[model samples]
Target: MMDALFITLQVILAVIAVYQFVFSLFGMYRKKKKAHFPATKSFAVLVAAHNEEQVVGALMENLKNLDYPKELYDVFVICDNCTDGTADIVREHGIQACVRTNTNLRGKGYAIEWMLKELWDMPRQYDAVVMFDADNLAAPNFLSEMNDDLSGGARVIQGYIDTKNPEDSWITAAYGISYWYINRLWQLSRHNVNMANFLGGTGMCFETKMLKEIGWGATSLVEDLEFTMRSVQKGIYPKFNYDAKVFDEKPLTFKASSRQRLRWMQGHFTVARRYFFPLLWQSIKERNLVKFDLALYSVNVYIVLLTFLMTAIMGIDAAVFNGPNIANIYGYLPLGLSFVAVGASILTFMAAMALEKVTFKKVYAYLILFPIYLISWYPITFYAFFTQNNKQWSHTEHTRVVRLEEVVQSKQV
Candidate 1:
């Protein structure tokens, strides 16, 4: 019975691994050259902040210098539950700031929903709405690239996620590397294969009509993932725009990073539970590849758990059962395959870094530290699985005050 159970589990894991491996290969497709278009669509840029007085000003300054037409895009800062000078700073910059003091319905998702209602009530109309965190810095061509994406028939678009302070600490560097890897392997791959792309909280643009059609009711901790899943359910797939870059601040310490990831995993599991079955049924009923892919992606956390279970099971079988096991049956083949997997991962990371124009020498230490950082996610995700009901938002404090020019200069180097 145990042998049969082991084989069943191994088969399940092998299939899942093969699926992801195929998707990773899809990322190797050449990047589509982005075409510039006239800034025809007007955008209402929304920045949700919670006492983000330190970095909000820098974002406002960066928004002011966007390469897109000044009259075409308007910036609004939603100062959600802020007891600081965030609103004052926005007003000082000659921009509008919408302040919300609702302690009960806090968080970026609620703030966005509230602000959307306010925007809809106004006589002014916008073609789309773009979201950004208070600590993010947009490249000058950010809006322009989004405009091109819209012109190219992408209704909902996710801009490229870049790191503002990758060299700040090991935690930040790991986050940076992870984002780079996801951008190339996950986002770009999905884009190439016409699969659904995910919104990275910030740097996401939603057409006003799409927003009204779907309604931004994603009030989960990871509202971005919830919204993406909801949109997929409604037959809207977000497009990934590699040309549009948005620089975001990452957590500096492992504790801070783990807490943020825990919140994300909790939300991830919640979303998967809510949507997995529906997506699976939808995929089967409609014979939709997009829905099927999304359904599989939703349960990725479970796959991680299954991987841990497999390792534990193998260890138990070797220890408790004693003598040579299935692993030894293959002799050095298992060990050789492990080396191959490690080598493949290293090559993939190198490719991601090179494509993102990151200086490898500068981030070499972080590369060595990445295995520990990646391993930490397992414990965080495991804890988050049990405590998924805890919806309390633990915000990561961002104090990195880097400017857009500095980021741009560093990239050029």
Candidate 2:
């Protein structure tokens, strides 16, 4: 009975994982027609900076040269409790800067909340608000695409996120690969079906009315996911803009990337705990498949950790029951389920590369390390699940200055 129960549990996880994998596979075939909208909405660009002196100025410069009417958009920078020259740099460029000083209210969520309130009190109201990190460089036509989308009637939108220094280290390479995979396989797949897209922390836009209605109440470490999952309950879906590209600076070292990913894992699990049950119940009660999809996607970290734990328990049983010189259960047990998931992941990334025509030798070389990076997530997920309360946000340092032109040329790889 014990063995049967364990086998049944593994079978359940394998089923859910396989279902998600198949959906992702199905999402690869994007057939939806994109309706172009006129470019006319006014936007307020928001940047929340914390000691980002190294790269904030470059971001402002990139904004000033965007291919859109100057009058259509304005930039705002929030130097949140920075003891550095981030504020000075913003002021030197004659940009609107807000210096926040409340130490208790830390992280990007608080900074965004403060800025939204400030924007609300201003004399002129913006039709939409777009967000970017201090280290991000916008593609010259990013705003134009966003403007087109906003004019066409998409209320909330997440732009494409690319990396700046993909060749800086193996970690950066893996990070870049992860983004491209998610961008092509995950977001585009959802968009292909006219479903909601998940918002990254940066390179996203929200309608002014939506922001006012919901407020930036998602103060978790991963504010973007928090906001996306919570807001879907109200039937408002976020859309995607494939052309609005923003090059983000990825961490160049494992230690740095681990800390950054740890926060993400912690925040993902935390938000899942709070919203998954309610959202799942609502999805079934109302027959809303979009919300159901979002609920399943949000709990991915938990699913992975659970898989490892169940596999571990099986190993323990193999040891205790077999006594001395116990035989391995690699073939008999469902450990192959994990490998199947990993194989599906590799195929997903390879397919994304093919879709983008990424034949670059260096990118292919870097992609070989993706399985290693994917496996490392298991340890980090376990660590984060046990230690989620130490939520003092750790900011990933960024100093790379790669621009959109490099991204366009395909030489950054």
Predicted structure with the largest lDDT when compared to the true one? 1
Residue-level lDDT of model 2, residues 1-413, one tens digit each, is: 66566567667676786776666765566554766656678999999899999989888888999988899899999899999999899988889888889888789988898889999999999999999999998988888888878778788899999877777788888888888888888888788778889999999999899889988898889999999987898888899887788889999889998999999999898889988988899999999999998898788889879867765666676687653232333356598765876777678878887775664566677776777888889889999999887768888888777666766676534
| lDDT by candidate, in order shown | 0.87, 0.84
Candidate 2 local Cα displacement, residue 292, angstroms: 0.7
- Per-residue lDDT for 45-112 in model 1, tens only? 99989989999999999999998889999999999999989999999999999999898887788889
Error of 1 at 55 (Å): 0.6
Q: Give the TM-score of candidate 1.
A: 0.94
Off by over 4 Å in 2: 1-5, 30-33, 316-342, 411-413
